[model samples]
Target: MFSKILVANRGEIAIRVFRACREMGIATVAVYSETDRDALHPKMADEAYNLGDGPAADNYLNIEKILQVAKESGAEAIHPGYGFLAENAPFARACDEAGVVFIGPPASAIDAMGSKTRARELMKEAGVPIVPGTTEAVDTVEDAMRIAKDEIGFPVAVKASGGGGGKGFRVALTEDELQGAFEGASREGEKFFSDPTVYLERYLPNPRHVEVQVLADKHGNVIHLGERDCSIQRRHQKVIEEAPAPEWVVDEETRERIGKIGVDAAKAVDYVGAGTIEGLFSSDTNEYFFLEMNTRVQVEHCVTEMVTGIDIVKQGIKAAAGEELDYQQEDVVLRGHAIECRINAENAARNFAPAPGKVGSYKEPTGPGVRVDSGLEAGGEVSPMYDPMVSKLIVWDADREQATKRMIRALDEYLIEGLTTLIPFHKTLLQTEEWAKGDTCKELLEDKEWLKSTAPAEAPKPVVEDEDEETAESKYLVEVSGKRFDVRVVGPALSAGVVAAPANGAAPAAGGGRKPKRGERKGGAAGGPDLVESPLQGNMWKVLVEQGQSVEEGQLICIIEAMKMENEITAPKAGVVEELHVKEGEPIQTGAPIAKIVAAAAE
Candidate 1:
């Protein structure tokens, strides 16, 4: 076994690899960028090295820097924990040249699978059921149009050869849309992957995104760890994944057959360590076609781990160390159903825009059969440089039905204040009848009405009483800097306050309080107190207000960059800016005072 391994990744995955290494009594070396100097993975590892600037190209993806870190740390092996340089063939070969073990499949396998078109050709030659599409790269729009007509026919997808995620992909329903899609896909491909080569594929309109997880050892022993149904997706990105694929849809016979196919594909590549064979399953014809093989651990690997009770990371490391298969194909057993929900820092209501900010209250769900693989803490800033996935929530149950219920309950308990999250969206998805019935496909993207219906109901409006008795009532005056604002409090304890004044000058009656209810006040005549405004949670990227400055509504007060993305903090209403409590680049917890915005009196 290796004494020390360098984890060439960041975020949750790096932490995950570190945990596995720790359990095996192997020391871990973490590499971080300038932005991630205070990242969780660096703190968790035994030794850490700087990978340069925050940009992926300058830091995580820089092969020379990663190799330097490995050499400096005296790491025997380098584990590319998915994303960044994980599937880069050159990185693997470089590790070999540097006399360091690469904890993944052979470089040859990565090269073959690195390009989608090449992988399709190899899979076809290996007698795997490949999707009907062009086996070669199409350089021009004319070539794409010709191939769409001659080979794939109508409704063809133009995809980047080296593209992953949902980028560099465009679907053309007709001939008129072919040229535009080709150009757009090519542009994105070149920008993202530095590869402009694009390919065409026959679009399977309503196919389920099903994939089989496989593990192999150096001795050519390969085994499939069952299938995961990832039909629930948005923008071609999987949102929810379930293991064993709901016995009714996959059945016992189909499972065995698919498992065998997965194993064969892995063996064909002489693959070692953990990988996944993703496929698109047509429910109408019950036909499955090979999509692409992910050459590294998948984001949804947790679901399979829950069902198999196996530590995949440990197995991956052991295999990379040239170990033999410890268990036979028959020895592998599937237990209860498992499901995983990728919790991202995005606003589901706003077209799923990335909502990167400070994590004010980062609370994860915990219970029987519930597990959370996260790299965030209470005050961790969600940076915008990396993937928006904050964490993964995986739950297990005896059956799919129970698993769904448990997942919903877990999501309810999962709280991430300060920024918007997809928790409500996940909760809505769990309650969907089609989801519960296992009726999902890629076509779910076209159903905007169905998607909108799953959103949570808006909060109820607060009711206000008459303003006459409000003047005589005791009012609390909270001073935020030099600005003073008047607010009516119902209870004796100021913490019991709830509703802020609505735009209509009506003081809404407070509902439930931390303590008993008190009387209400009218206006500034009632001697209202002033209060300071602060960011919900996140590092204080900048302080926009000074001691005394008149500010209007919708003014950009500060900018908080979390999870590698920037969030603009705006003024709630027209007020005079008073005291600025925070400075730039300072980490602030949830409810930390940011500035004081004193409300203007009625004219």
Candidate 2:
């Protein structure tokens, strides 16, 4: 085992790795960006280093700086955690060449599965079940159309070859939509993964997203833990995940088959350490198709751990240290059902808009069968520069039904003030009949009814009475130890009277602020009807409109990148652009002016 390990990630995952290292008696090093100086992960690590001040590319994704920190901190291993450089092959190779173990699969395994197109080809060659699609990257719209129409037929998926997690993925049902989907997917692939390559696959409209968790050792021993059902999603991103996928949906026979297939996929790449093989399972035909492989511990790995009682991270580290598997396939026992709800700093009512700010008054749920993996506290800040996820609420029970109910109880008890969260959404999702049946509630999330109905609950207002009026009915009940006394107040009631503010300690009333002027908006310090203010805090990625350019209502004017997601700022009404206040690549806060728009003049 390594004496020290450096975690090359951020947020909850970083903290998770730190906790694992602590339990194993291994020192942990944390690297942070400028915005994350006060982040919980850094505060919890044995030692911390500042990678730099800027976006992820300049900080967390800076392989050289991370390697430098590892060497300086005297760390012998680097755990990528997940996301960012987790699946980057070159970074793994760099760690290997630097003589520091990368606590993940070898670089060769990552390279084999990093690209979706290449992975599909390898899987097919290895006799693993794969979806019908092109075996190579689709170059142009013509190629995509040919592949979709001639080979895979219509309703094909155009996905990024170099990434997963719903990024750079689009589905086109008709030939006319192929061109747009192809271009959009390619653009997103380049922007997110720095890879413009893409490939086509047969799109499954209602197939469930099921995945198998596999652990492999350097001694060529590979075994799968079990399957997790991650079908509940929004915008193709998983919102909830559970292990031992409902027996009614995936029977024992299917589970054993998929587990072996998972091991086969890992062995094909000579994989070592912890990894996940995602596949799309069809209920209609009882068939499953390979989706992609995650090369590190997953966000939903907690649920797998809950059921299997395996410390996957520790095993991964041991494997990296040239250790062999301690347990065989028969030794693995999956017990109760577990579910994980990803609680993100987002407003479900407003299209799940990212809500990044200081978390005030955070009260996590605690009870039997409940666990919270979070990096935030009462006063910690959730910045827009990283993922919007605040925490993960994982619950376990003897069965799926009990787990569902327990999850609802936990979600209801979890409280996070000063910022909107998905608690209400999770509560609503768990209560649904479809969810109770272990069915993917994708449609429920997309339904306007729930989206419009599940806003954060409002706090109740305290009653205020006039001090003068309270004098007529002033009564006080006083208690001393076990004794109680009733007394009538002669003047205004003490509770009714407001305390005078200290000379230098006066506080403002709630909702006390300068009101916007007529035709002015809520965003920006100074803004009129014409000012187009940013709705969220993020870095300006692109400005679509120029000065004096005419734009219609709801037209996209600019793009702001926040929380690794891009949000498009649109025009309020038809108008001519007046002035631009922000430039490309500049960081912007909520209510910051993006541009000014003047109503178009009538002829």
Candidate 3:
């Protein structure tokens, strides 16, 4: 067992690993960029190091710097908590060379499964089912066109060989869209993964996203915890996940089969530690096809832990220390249903755009069957420099129905002021007809009108804007027994006709600063109906329209990259583009003018 372990990540995942290490009587080390100097993860660790300021490449993704920190802190192992360098084979090998244990699979295993194409090839040879697609990388658009038409057919998926978590993946519904999808996938692959290789696959229209969690050791002992249904997603990323996939879609028999498939895939690469085998499961045929493998702890692992009564992080660390797995296939069991909703700093009403900013009055729910995994606290900031996930709300119950009800209760109790979050979205989705019937809810997720209906509820403005005309009660400080107290005095003040006045709708607090307001729209006000405004803050990724160009109603005008998700801004009406206000690669603010569209009727 390692005396000290360093977590090479941030936010909730880092805290998660730290908590596990504490339980195992191990000291924890934390590293942070200057941007995260005061982050909760570092505050919770036994030792901390500063990686300087800048983007992830200069800090989180710098293998050498992290290794240096580990050695300086006397850490024996490093845990790359998902995302940045979790699955980077070179990072794992570097840890080996540095004589520090990497609490994940070997570099050989990561190399075997890191590339989507290579994983497909290996899975096929290992008798593990794979999605029907080209096994080899398609370098040129010409080659991709031929493969899509001659082999896969229309509605083909162009995916980066090195991509996961929905990045560098695109779809071509028809011949005209193929070239763009091909190039886009290749470009994103090179930019994100340093690989321009992409492959083709037949896109399943409404397949459910299911993943199985497996733990393996170097001693050849492997076992699966269970499966998680992650069908509820936005922009190909999961927003909600539940363990022991719904019985209606995946029965006991199907669960056992997929569980075995997961074990087989892990065995094929000699994988060790915690890993996830993501697959596209068909609700119709009850068949499963492998998507890819995540080589580290997952963001939604809490739901699985809640149901399985197993500590996945502890097992991963034990495996890295050359210990045999404690469980066999028969020993693993799932007790109850658990659901996790990702509480992100996003606005579902405006297409789930990222809403990163400081949070105020943060309050997480408590009581039985409810858990919150978060790194944020009151007055903490949700930096746009990182992912939008502010926290994860996980709830467990005897069954799916009760679990859902518990989740809703927890959501209602949870409060995060000063920024928009997905609480409303989760509350809305859980009660939908599709969710109740175990459907994938694909149509609902893609429906703009339905998404708009999930916007955060706001309190009505007080009718009397002038507080002077109001007779509302006011409080004043009064000393009592050497203690300070606030007392409300309204009787004589009302009779004396005392004028009242205040800037905020709610009276000021005892500390003097105003209580953080909710649903407050900042920046320039949106003007005329013909003028489209940016609904959220982000950088302009692409501007699809030119000034004076004609467009149909709801046509995509531009893409905004916020908190790592691309949001499409569309035309509000059929009109001619009179002017474009935002340029590509520039920062935009919420309510900032986007474009001016003169309605066709006026023209």
Candidate 4:
């Protein structure tokens, strides 16, 4: 066992790894950027170091800074939790060169599986079924056209060779749309991953997003821990995940088959530690095709842990230390159904736009089979510089129905303030007929009206602040022997506070309270319907239209990259484009008019 391990990550995942290390009696170290000095992950570590300032590139993604911290903190190993440098092959190699263990698969494995095209080729060689398309990179739009028109037919997916988590991915449903999708995927690939190569895949419209969790050791032992159904997603990224695949989507025989496929995939790559083999599984056909491999602990690993009763993090650490298999394939058994909801600071009504702001009244639900992996408190802020995920709410029960009910209860009990969250969305989603029948709820997700229904019905009651500071603290103060002492209670009370409870028994809505302190935004000037306003805060990654350019109704006008997701702002009506306001690579805010349109003949 290692004496100390440095977690090269932040937020909930960092806290998760720390907890596992503590249970295993290993000292933990944490590194944080200047913006995250007050964050929870650093506060929980046995040792903490500052990793410079600003965005991830200056901090978490800075391999040298992270390595320096590890060396200074005397950490024996580095655990790159599932983001930032988690899948970076060079980081893994750097850890090895620094004489510190990288608690993951070897760099070779990461390199082998990191590129989507290369992974597809390897899977085909290993006899694992993959989505039909190019097994090689298509460098030009011309090649993409040829591949889509002749090789794979229509509805082809243009995927960045190094993409994951929905970035650098686009779908072209027709020949006319192929060039745009190709260029978009390549651009995002170059920007995010520094890899401009892309590949085509036969897009499986509305296929179930299933993945198998595999654990392997350096000593040639690999095993699968069943499957997780991650079909509930927005913007092609998962928001909810459930274990054992609902039993209806995956039968016992198919489960065994997919389990073997997962094991085989790991073996093909000579993989080590914990990894996930994501696939597009068809319930109607009882067949699964390989999608890609995530060479790190997944975001939804908590649901897997709840059912399997396996401390995957601890096992991963042991494997890195050259430990043997603790359990054979026969010993692994899933006990119950588990579901995980990614609680993000986002507004579902506004197309799941990121709503980064400070938290006010934060409280987690507590009960049997309910777990919250979070990093924020009542006063914490969800920074727009990172992913929108604030926490992961997981629950378990003997069956999917019971698990659904428990999740509903847990969601109702969770209270977050100051900003919007997906709680309202999750509440409505779990109660729908689609969930009961194991449907993906694609229609509802695509329906704008249906999404609006998931928004909070009302804001909380106003909390007036008129009393003087001394006067407010006077009542909370207690003094002996005529000695006056100051004690203060600020903000709204947990109950009967500013918040108004929802009619569906869900958590109270945000955006109500007395003026106390931190976190405010710069409102952007908005115009009428003809003006295309930015729906949320983000960077203007690209502007697709120029002044006086004619555009059709609902045509793409701009792409706003917010919280690692690209939101395409479109024309509201058929007209001549004018008043172009957004600049490329500039910060944009909600209601900001990026462009405008008038009568086409007027131009």
Best-fitting candidate, scored by lDDT: 4
lDDT scores of the candidates, listed in order: 0.81, 0.87, 0.88, 0.89
Off by over 4 Å in 4: 459-531, 548-550, 576-578, 596-603
Compose the digit string of candidate 2's lDDT tens values, residues 1-603.
789999999889999999999998999999998788767899999998888797788999999999999989999999999998999999999998998999999899999999898899899998999998888998999888877888899889999898688889988999998987898789889998889999999998889999999999989899999999999998788889999899899998999989988999999999999999999999889999998999888899999999999988889988998988777999999999999999998777767778787877889999999999998987788888778899999999999999998999999899787777788888887887988887888788788777868886683122222323333323456777978756434444234236434233555233323434534654455877889888788889888889989999999899888877778889999989988898898899877888888988899
Q: State, as a TM-score between 0 and 1, how close model 1 is to the true structure.
A: 0.76
Number of the top-ranking candidate, with TM-score as the measure:
4
TM-score, model 4 to reference: 0.88
RMSD of 1: 14.8
- Tens digit of per-residue lDDT, candidate 1, span 1-603: 999999999889999999999999999999998778766879999998876775789989999989988888899999999888999999999999999999999999998988999999889988889889988999888878788898779999999998877768889999999987898678668867789999999998778889999999998789989999998887777888999897777987888888888988888888999999999987678888989999999999999999888888999999999987677788779999999999887766544556566676678999999999998877676776676888999999999999999999999899776656678888887887778789883344456665565454652122222333323223566667887766543323233334455444677555433322344422221112344443334556556676688788888788665443345677777888765667888865444566767886679
Pairs in clash, predicted candidate 2: none
Candidates sorted by TM-score, descending order? 4, 3, 2, 1
Q: In order, how many clashes per candidate?
A: 22, 0, 0, 0
Name the lDDT value of residue 162 in candidate 4.
97
lDDT by residue (tens digit), candidate 4, 1-603: 899999999999999999999999999999998778778999899988888778799999999999999988899999999989999999999999999999999999999999999999999999999999998999799888987888899999999999999988999998999998999899889989999999999998989999999999989999999999999988888989999898878988988999999999999999999999999998888779999999999999999999999888988999999997687899899999999999998989888988887777889998989999998887787887889989999999999999999999999999987778999999999999999999988888989999999998774222323432211111245576998645433333453434434334566444444444333435455678677787788899888899999899889898898888888888878988868888999998777788878877752
TM-score of each: 0.76, 0.86, 0.86, 0.88
User: Of the pair 1 and 2, which is ahead by lDDT?
Assistant: 2
